[model samples]
Target: MKGIKFDGNHSYDAYQLFLNSYSIGEAEPNTNLVEIPGVDGAVDFTEYFGGVTYKSRILKMQFTFIADRFGLNAAYAKLQNALNGRRVKIVLDDDREYFYTGRVSVGALSPDGQIGEVTLTATCDPYKYKTKVRTATCYGHTVGKGVGTVDSPTVTLIHASVTNTGGAPAVPTFNGDKAFYVTATERHAGGSSDTFLNESESLPSGKDTAISGVEIPAGATQEFGFCCVGEGDLTVTIKLQERSL
Candidate 1:
């Protein structure tokens, strides 16, 4: 069953939309060129500095909508109401483990009685993100690897619990580089099961200022080390989404 899932809803299952054919565009790199006065050629910033930027990719699909009891017009209306002009999480049947975030444009519906044909064009982000988020938990020190073609800039500190065994406060670091402090009010009391991550509100004051997060390079193992200003026991968990071209 070859089909497309938009925003976690399957096209075929929800609307009886059958995918006839599909095509994916190439991951074209965007060029950075600077024109200089009296220079023969434009200065290529991307080529000289080895930095690459990508434009949005396109995914086109041809689909046939089969109407049941409601009719073709009803089916078309339902499909339009669900997808048109909306940003969606696109998951193809061929690759269920990865997803692309994009906006879908539905073409005009051409109908022959109960059946109709239409085209869908998705303008997606350059990278295909892994569905599963990778998590690494450590008591004091641990190693974790990022699995993708590009480095992930948004790493989240999902959980942290620190107890100062010594006289001073403790600070934990992600990848032994970026440091975030734990306040006395935010310390774990060892009785409650509350979590700080994924909360609706912003992080506590002072805790959000220090930790800027770390960049995890693709396919490289990075060490996460936690050190206390005095002596303390710390447990922290971090998560990241890996993406590739």
Candidate 2:
């Protein structure tokens, strides 16, 4: 049967939670719908202004596994530790190459007979989920230099770091679509904040002067690139997060 693999440790497909290497079932993925209610008997519009809109979505899965008496208890014990309140990665289809991260809370363990079967119902909590991330590192980048080009793979969320490799200070700035800027002293590292893409209202600093909430769409490229001004060998590392959908 078709199944999904759970990865909490980034082991790829190695650590599927299925006890017998099989997935029993899954619930239909649901959309988190937001309904905007209209004022009753409003004079301006024909229909009520209230309509259902969609945004972040979530899914719940009920996976059952079977193991002999020898492996039953061990499997349940592993599930308890592996899934409880943990942000885990999931791969539903390898061909699709899509991944998702969410908090997994495993419900009660129901044992059928002594060790024949165990059913685990897990609820996935999600504000967002990510597919595989692509990372690139630029080393020994000099100041007052121009970076050639930068692009996003999807509606990507990116986190970047500029580490001072030399003895003196460096200030790095990336200007273009969804640009990022940082100012760091000697031997210090400054980068994008984790909340840079998550915080919609305000700009969060990455321990320096930077802008948060840069939304880069898929297949879009930034032509300007990032540059630095300072005394040290600057290493720039960038990580991009693509939405699972």
Candidate 3:
């Protein structure tokens, strides 16, 4: 009954394949070391280059494909077609709440009578992403909680509507850092059904649209609201995914 789901296709149901064994490779650190002329050990430049970087993780799975209604050759072909060179989301039966994204390489399939054993190696990203995407609604200066072992870099803003009550423009802030600016023309009046005008528009001049410096830290509650040059009220929804090593 133990199997893997690759790109939304169940291995057992699709190819009559069952997981026999598996192994996960640890994330290797990407370090820079300099060998000195007479030093006992190499000088580590990992900290100098903004801390340690992580290489891609590896997941190896051994599966036994039992020929049922379909012949062994047909089933093996199906499995090859599904995973050969495709980058997909891989979800193991043991960890249903997290998924790894990578390209699966199908190894040699050794056939014995009606069964064939195959090895699958997945070169995955360093982190596993949560299956569920969490949402946080912000009303003015609202705070939201983050749950994960690592910080998430992807944050999306949606259903954003702003009302500028003061004379100056309002800029959205996440953890006291500027996100984007809202001009007077983009503001919605009180009781207006129209959303903010700059929902999908690019940021103001010299501002990047990609949200940065606003990552949700692991197990921390951060404030995500607006700071006005005068006064403003903003209503928006934030969506993000939690990731871990």
The TM-score measured for candidate 1 stands at: 0.64
TM-scores of the models, in the order given: 0.64, 0.46, 0.65
lDDT of each residue in 1-245, candidate 1, tens digit only: 67999988898999889999998888798888899999999988875654476899999989998675448888888999999888999999998877889999989998866678999899999878763222233343322212221212332223432222222122333332223222212333674232222122222322322244333445543333222222223333433455677
lDDT (Cα, tens digit) per residue for candidate 3, span 1-245: 77999988888888788889988899898888999998999998986956356899999999998785347778878888889888999998899877899999988878887688889999999877762222233345422212321112232222332222222222333222233332222223563222222333323322323253333445533333222221223332333455677
The whole-model lDDT of each prediction reads 0.59, 0.39, 0.59
For candidate 1, what is the total of clashing residue pairs?
A: 0
Q: Which stretches of candidate 2 lie over 4 Å from their true place?
A: 1-3, 9-58, 62-66, 93-96, 112-141, 145-210, 231-234
lDDT of 2: 0.39
Cα RMSD for candidate 2?
12.9
lDDT of 1 at 113: 64
Rank candidates by lDDT, best first: 1, 3, 2
